[model samples]
Target: MKIAIYTLGCKVNQYETQAMEQELSRRGHEIVSFSGAADAYVVNTCSVTAVSDQKSRQMLSRARREHPGAVVAVCGCYPQTRPEDVRKLDVDLIAGTGDRMGFLDLLEQELEDRRPMEAVDRVFDRRAFEILPAGGLEGRTRAMLKVEDGCVNFCSYCIIPYARGPVRSLPPEEAAARAKELAAAGYQEMVLTGIEISSWGGDLKTGQSLIDLMELLSDAAPGLRLRLGSLEPRTIDGDFCRRAAKLPNLCPQFHLSMQSGCDETLKRMNRKYDTARYFRSVALLKEYFDRPAVTTDMIVGFPGETEEEFAQSLDFIRRCGFARMHIFPYSIRPGTPAAELAQIPAAVKESRAARAAAVADEMRKEYLEGCVGQVYPVLFEQAKGDRFSGHAPNYTEVLVPGSENLHNRVLATRITGTEGFSLLGELEETP
Candidate 1:
């Protein structure tokens, strides 16, 4: 069987698609390009914003139209959140966010029986973390290991809490074993990713925190560089910083979720922390790690956000000095609480997004320039022309002219300059 997977939004979805691809390939299936012909088409979807939902619908519809007889399988956050929308589509198999192995079984069953099937369950009732196969089919240098699942935050603007259910975490032993396997498989880095990683250990009876899991992973795979996904600001404390700082294999990049910088806006958005608390997390990372890259996400023109509040947010983000930022103009999801509030005009939202993007672009350039003359251990992943490009411990892209076979090797690189969005550097000769 030939399978084509079309994934949309977030690293967790990508990780899930990769896991499914691996399992399907192991079962004697040929994975083909999404644009090419295939007997099965899997559309892993997202529902973070209105735009994502639209894209999900478009992809599902296109898959069905392109291959009239192919099995159209829809999965992920979109179907988990709004199965009714998916039911209207011409899909053969529908699986929600959880239960990847079960989804595969259903897919194979449908192939054998040629029956339309739906396996989506009530995501809110899920208690245990559904562990999937780790490592990606494409990359040898880096792999995303989903250690946590579900979010309970329930922010006013977010529908993910309902889509993903309560916090469920992979046990420390399981995470450690996966990391060791990835390291043994020649992966240089493994990212600890999930829906809400900071909320890890909340549903567990063991009372161990994310810090404990990090410690275990570092110990189990001493040779692999462990990296974190997006984190809640309040999760970082003095103890976590101290312990995480001691882990030599951990990357020094922190991505704190700062949706809105204005306190009033944060209150409206139901965020757990204020600007002061978020700044503290930023300060702690800088204090503990050596020149760590701090990145974040922000939503502009949220519900009931005033011009003054937006200005304050712009000012606040400049103060935080983020190395990179994902700036989103707020979009209304029909079921979310924020969608019912007084909405901002589309023109205003887009204008604010542009302004915020300009500020973020400058900060990104400054951060890249700051990398000049610094020496870093870059794990090369791909090549462009005669040069191989990879990422440093801080997750900054560093490109250097080298042999083509730099894949999966950690070479010392000294930063020289910047070209376009990438940092240009050269390989360091070690005596």
Candidate 2:
């Protein structure tokens, strides 16, 4: 069977799509492109926000339009959460966030029977992490080993907890094995990705934590660089900071999730942490890692979020001095609690988003300027012209003008200056 996958949203979704691709290949199936004719087209959907749902629908529709005769299989967060909406679409197979292997089987059945199949079940009944293949088979420098699944946070604005169910973790031993497999495949970097990585060991029950798993994986792949996915602010503590910083190969870039910076807004959103706590996490990252890239996300114009609250959020984020930021204007999702709360005006949301973006841009520029004259072991992934570009240990994009194509090679590059948002420099001889 020839399969083509179209994936949207988080790194976890991308990881899942790759895992499915691996499974198909193992069963003697060919992976093709969605734009080309194929036996089946898999739409790995996302439902993080309202926009994500729309994009998922658009992609599903496009797949059907492109290959009307091909089997259209839809899975992931969107179909998992809104199966009725997906049922209205021209799809042959429907499965939810869980059971990738089962979803593949259903797709195979549909291929043979020439009939539609829906294998989705209640997401909350899900238990145990469905471990799948790690590393990229498509020749990528970085591969994500999803160590965690599901979210229990139940933040008022989030529907993911309901869509994904309770927390499930991959055992430390298994995670280590997966990391070693990825490293053996010549991958230079591995991202510890998941739905909510900070909550990794919450469901494990054993006397282990995310730090313990990190220690094991780092030990397993001593030569491979390790990067982390988005983490909850409450996850960062003195112990986590000290232990994680000790790993030499672990990248110092930390993306602490900060939906809203104001304490009042956080309370309304039912977030687990406050602005003070969030700032402490930021301070800890700054203290432990030598100039680590501390990035964050912010939602503007949340339901009932006053102008004063938005200002407070902006002020708080500016004080944190994030290296980069994702600024989003809050949008109402039908099933979320925030959707039923007092709504903010769309124009107001747009205005606040723009203001937050400006502040974020300044912080980004300041952080990049700080990188000037610093030498970093940059894993150059690709090149355009004579410049080989890659990310620094802190996730700073560094472009070095070199004659050689430094693909997959970690080169010592000194940051000469900034070129727009990226650092421009030349390759330096090894000391």
lDDT of 1 by residue, 338-406 (tens): 999999999999999999999999999998999999999998888878888889888888888756578
Worst 10 residues of 1 by lDDT: 422-431
Ten residues in sequence with the least summed lDDT for candidate 2: 422-431
State how far residue 210 of model 2 sits from its true place (Å). 0.9
Best-matching candidate per lDDT: 1
Off by over 4 Å in 2: none
lDDT of each: 0.91, 0.90
